[model samples]
Target: MRSTLMDIAREAGVSTATVDRVLNNREGVRERTRQAVLETARKLGYVTPPDEEGGNANAPVRLDFVLPAGTNTFIANLLDQLVTQAGAQDGMDVHVHSIEGFNPDSLARQLDALTGTTQGVGVLALDHPTVREAMRKLAASGVPIVTLVSDILHVPRLGYVGIDNRAAGRLAGYLLGRLLGKGAKRKIALFAGSLSYRGHEEREMGFRHVIAEEFQDLEVVELREIRDDRQRAFEETAALLKRHPDLSGIYNIGAGNAGIGQALQEAGFAQSVIFVGHELTERTKRFLLDGTMDAVIDQNPRVEAREALAMLKNTVLGRRFDYHPPRLQVIFRENIPEF
Candidate 1:
């Protein structure tokens, strides 16, 4: 059994109030009594939790950061940046977690469990109704949630910390059109981690809108959902290419770059296909350097880490701060950043 203040008081022959003062180091009791109480607490293993002056301060802020599990280099890099930020920020006590694939049911359950104990949360959640409801309950209790890489619509939140994915998709469409440049009738296919993600869906919408209005010759097939698995991506990509030999381009708004690269190479279409994908990971960087990929849409993870931690700190501290959207960086073979 663990010890309590009353137990410490009983063992030391002192009042609970004196024990409280001594535990808080508030100063009032005589030095002899203070020393005795301290020694008793030490012997009893009574750890003093930091005082809640502003609720999550005197110590680090306890935040639950939930991500999806996979070899998605973009997410992996983002996770590393966040872990570094957690170590650097004395105000941020982040506990990182990962759920398998695009399972919103599990994500919702985890969100519900984080209430009442953790001060805040960060997530790359599916835009599902149950997940939103769970977030609503937590928000009602003043537990701030900041959605990273994706945003849930019509729900209260600290803020969304990512690029305008719609704009990215539109740019992707334009880039594809420019690369193919008045080529013979073209067919393009789009891939996604999952349309359940608002970011990926928005990207799809923007891609479709641009292809329809600006590039009529570029025809897009229905979206292929990979669930961010490399094997799934490899199989689906191989099947799609075999099914459509005339496929001119591909835009994977999600991830699994290695799978995409492998399928393209094995199918003997890496040189012929016009590819545009998101994020600047080592795999994608190699593709760009080797001329396997044409362009990459990168969201700067360092800036994201700094902004996300700041947003969580302000929200927990109840301070008003301006929210600015991070810029979307486009990389070409000629301008790849140092690996």
Candidate 2:
């Protein structure tokens, strides 16, 4: 059996109250006494208990979450769900901080600042060398990390809880190709978010691969580095429509479905074009319902948030978790649940 606070107090030749003060880092506990208590606790492998109900605990675990800042509905909803779930957990407090954009230097600075104060971190970070180095530093500080949505390749993270972007992209490609009719020569326009995002990059790659391998008649014109800006997307879509009047399909590997849908509507090509995109946000859901968006590759943000919190608790509390395959759900217009 693992040791308890009482065992730690007895072994350290201190009272339970003193041990509590030391463990919780409360003031008035002598340095020497605190060291004794900590040493005893470490030697005996004493795990802290979960916080009790209806009372503030002596010590609470603090977790920091780093994400990208945007008015993007999907990300906002995901954060809201994560905050709700974290608030419900006993003794677990989550503080969310976001960088203005997917800038590695800014994200690295944020990670560096959290090294000592945070017990754990959940990141939706850009896949860059500097960000990876920061994650390594956090890991070295004995802070566990859980990655959300986007992944950091080869970093020793606790776990990743999100959709398989490549697979989802392939699904979108398949839907578009089939809807456009196999062997029908058609020009398809692809609008992507920043390629710095691993998820977006992977989705674009999968989309291209599927179009090349499965739908040879379909040619993809990729618009590069179009951040999820609605106005920009509208302008870009209008330009693409004007440039390629023969365009028969559109694929959005990122957010901004509303802008794309509006452009298609204004061009009077909504029913004629095969459109596919990611996420089922309020705007996208409405588009799908109105027959503007052909399909949406839905990654359930609620489920992702729930699993992330569960994984974080497991990691921090040293609880064992069974190996389960990554959870990725595909939501279509017919299957989209009412919120």
Candidate 3:
């Protein structure tokens, strides 16, 4: 015999009327109660109409995005684009959560919490063991996962939506090398948000590879962590300048461009030091214009947001999606586009 509302209600310890509300997507249902009712229904083979699963007949699918909270202009821009684009699409229901700091434990907890609430997930991954384990669990439980900006390896992610980070890093290295010239020996500083991020680690590797192979004269004297905070970046840069007064170049593997630029200006090395970094923001634009920054290797966040959303939605609906990596664009002062 087929299951009824009364059966689900009794099994879930809720009234039939409560079950009705949950099944029909009515309000006043507590999240825990709703989860209980839904789980009991599924367990008892109480099939609901396709449209009624998430909400009303025309309800949209829910997708959650996990991103960094306090720092990084590029991430903030990506979050804005995701919200705007998701709002425009009637079929997409987007929720965004920003993690305060680079804590893998906190990120893992957030991912674990989304198991029952969202149909799909897109995350700016922190490549740590705990976070990767959480992703594995989510994938095993049938929620489709897609990585944005950075990726976690050896996991079942639908796709990664971003530029080729290795190539971008190599390009930055080459640019810095050419700007500094091959004739003279010089010192360079490298900054990273965190090596726990796969993209950052890969960029550092690529940059080092290029510097070693092509620009042997340029020595990477310091490798520092900025945590993507402007203040932290400023302190690190200031200390670097004091230690190595002849710091000829800098390649930031991630964000925090504003802090580094400010530090350079205060130390009177803005024009002398060749600064190259990632992302093109309002602050970076000003730096490039004033000759404080040489070049910026950028990826289109709009395209990344679109591709990630499409990948999640397609996976949820059992459809196929094409993964097109965003092209890397080198932004110079002459070709800086107006926002």
Candidate 4:
């Protein structure tokens, strides 16, 4: 017997309406769920029926990816990979809309404009109240938004595709504490992208929590938000180093580790302090090899982009997804991927 819509829906664990949306190429489904439905359909020998009016058989799947714009090579590279992956997929069309920097008002405006045009949205956004309100409005407009890299709290996002940020931060703290040992009286500084990014903030909290509870001897200095600018990061690190000459460690929860490294090197303290940061970018990788950066917590950008696209597909197609826990990778000098 041929597989029916109901059968596909049952297998995919989504509503029949969702299945219909997927079949008819309508929007409003979560990307992950849409991928699940389609995968299930294909497994069950389900095929989309041809249009009766001899319309285009292949209806394009439209997805909008919204991201913060800056000179951050990691995010830019990830978006490039996402675009390539999306383009390679058959019967799918993806559009990318980048918000110029991390402005809440600008991001909201971009979101508002994409509401009607995009089937679904994938966002790497700050967790500001204004941003949350924009997401709420987008959800109300029948557009499912997926949070990428950073999470927006209490919003009706379809799903989040990134590492457990708090866990990553905790791992950093654990490593730092172990390396520094007890009664060290070492000072550890935290560098963040912006207080706006929920992921960075969560990382800071996790790092602080572990350091305080487990490693009480180590003193955590104030966290500095660098506005996601390399120059600013450099300046901030220089200022911190000048102020705290006895600093023993630095935790960077942002994308300016290279700048931090440079500042440290210029201050002649590169080899004196233990350094850890997020993301395994090219610069960070090189730093790791040269013994500048001790360790990096890598959130696989390729995997993130792939998952985001897959989730967009599922949401648009009204399909279900197999629940998979996101994984975090610890990149050290020995395990960094070659670019």
Candidate 5:
């Protein structure tokens, strides 16, 4: 007697619907399950469907979204968006990993381990020699990587999904100079989470370049690294006020705006100093409302998350997608977003 689909289902320990799908080369069946059904049919002298030879076309592309462990509101929100998007996509399985302590060595290890299995990865990169080299090697070995807010140049990543950091910095400088006025020479302070962050460095370059070309009178006294810690930011801002009593402006290139705002408030310089920072977090929003923070340069993380996913999906599917850079927002008190 000729073997039937029911024979394959019962012998292979699967439902009749599953055996039917595998026999007819339909999707929604896992590779292992399909293979098992195929092997069972062969043993039972059942004719295998010719369509099954091409393999599963609708298999989920397994991916990993690597995020740094931090309290940066923008990054935190970006991770959330990516997870939500992954859950909604039928053809993708995404696992979000937040590396503890953000040690590049640890990140590289995790990435190297995923080389064989993962289809693609999206990273909020830190600019370090080993980290860049590891990513480059991974991409060379067939795994594609895309950098998010903080990018790296060493690796030929699928693309970067963030604002033009230099332009953002230039805008900050322009706002600072405009708000500071041209009547008198004033000192400016630059605060960043770390100079090692390519985003921060790029912003600093653009800010300084613009300040030099357009507002020569506004002196940039120093670039302070507060490690993205609120206490450090508060201490640094307070120290900056003490050191540069005549400081007219401050531009923060990273998180910890809460500390920046509080320090300015306690020092009795909140209204006097022109304060500009990055991201539109609740902390910054409150500062903007209370007149502590004058301006915010927001790099929309939600938009970035969507863009990254679209671009990466195309890459995985071996297709092309248009790469459009997102415009950085220069927000003020009156233009605060409803969200």
Candidate 6:
């Protein structure tokens, strides 16, 4: 006896109408829910109709995700979530690539190489001429592009899937400024992964703007080109502390939280200097508890990865959908949720 859509829906724990939509390749079904229905249909030995392109309906759509090469906990979390979520989806074939040293030429070459290979691309792009040219060319070649985590200007991409970085930076600045408590002329150190990344640059701009407008007593001293390297962050932080022992606060526009925390602890300024950074990883959580970090601005990588994939696939399939930007969460020790 042949199985029915009702049977598949029952097994998939979704409504029969949703199973019908999935089997018919109709719009309005979510990517994961659609995949779940499809998996159930396959398990029940139900044959689905051919897709619009007249290919195997079950064949996956190939997409690539390009991220920076680093051990940054947030990036690592994004990579992991990309893999895990794509694995759960039936129609997404996601390939993740890391750009070495955040090199523009290398990233451009990578984009050029992927021209004919992938149906879509989601890149954490740098705001460089070569990289922008590559992205424009790729978009011109009929492949859809989506910017993930970071965005580039004047690019013909499908959409951006990440938090509002400028707002997040302002929030960080506000937390640090208020925590320092009506400072009577205090210094705050700002670190960035690199200004080349549009996200980081926007964060720096917002942080500086808030400090200048609201907290006139606080002076922001920045050390350039940290590159999100732990050792470099540690060294620069140690030297900065030695030069200005009265550094009242520290705000990292990017990663290297652990290194900054280590430097503060070693200098015996962990409790004195209010530290705020990005990402709510295990280490950052520990820092929040131990008073090494005062606040962390976090975005859910799982939501980002899933959104990126959905945007890519929907564009390739010419499906119209609404996009919601991911929300940013400000976490402290008091409100840190269990993973």
lDDT of 6 by residue, 1-339 (tens): 545555777899998668656654669999999878877766666653335345655778899988888868889899999999889978888899998747999999999999878888999988999999999888766567889888887986777899888998899889988999794888998999999999999998889889888999998765556788888889889998999898899999998998889999999999999999999999999999999999999998878987888877775654545676789898988999988
- Point out where model 5 deviates above 4 Å: 1-58, 100-102
Residues 94-185 of candidate 4 have per-residue lDDT tens digits of 88887876798898888888876777899999777888899887876656778998888788677788888889989999988887777847
In the range 20-116, model 3's lDDT, one tens digit per residue, is: 5665456899999988988887787655435555654356879999998877999999999999999888788999999965999999999999987
Q: Relative to the true structure, how large is the alpha-carbon lDDT of every model?
A: 0.83, 0.79, 0.87, 0.82, 0.82, 0.84
Screening candidate 5 with a backbone cut-off below 3 angstroms (N, C-alpha, C), the clashing residue pairs are none
What candidate 1 gets wrong by more than 4 Å, as runs, is 1-57
TM-score to true structure, per model? 0.82, 0.82, 0.84, 0.83, 0.81, 0.84
**For candidate 3, what is the lDDT?**
0.87
Q: Which model, 4 or 6, shows the larger lDDT?
A: 6
**C-alpha displacement of 30 in model 2, angstroms?**
41
What's the residue-level lDDT of 167 in candidate 2? 85
RMSD of 3: 9.9
Clashing pairs in 2: none
Looking at model 1, residue 55 earns an lDDT score of 49
What candidate 3 gets wrong by more than 4 Å, as runs, is 1-57
lDDT accuracy of residue 196 in candidate 5: 77
Instruction: After superposing candidate 4 on the true structure, give the runs of residues whose Cα lies further than 4 Å from its correct spot.
Output: 1-57, 323-325
Total backbone clashes of candidate 3, pairs 3 or more residues apart or in separate chains: 0
Model 1 residue 141 CA deviation (Å) reads 1.5
User: Could you tell me how far off, in angstroms, the CA of residue 47 lies in candidate 6 after the best superposition?
Assistant: 22
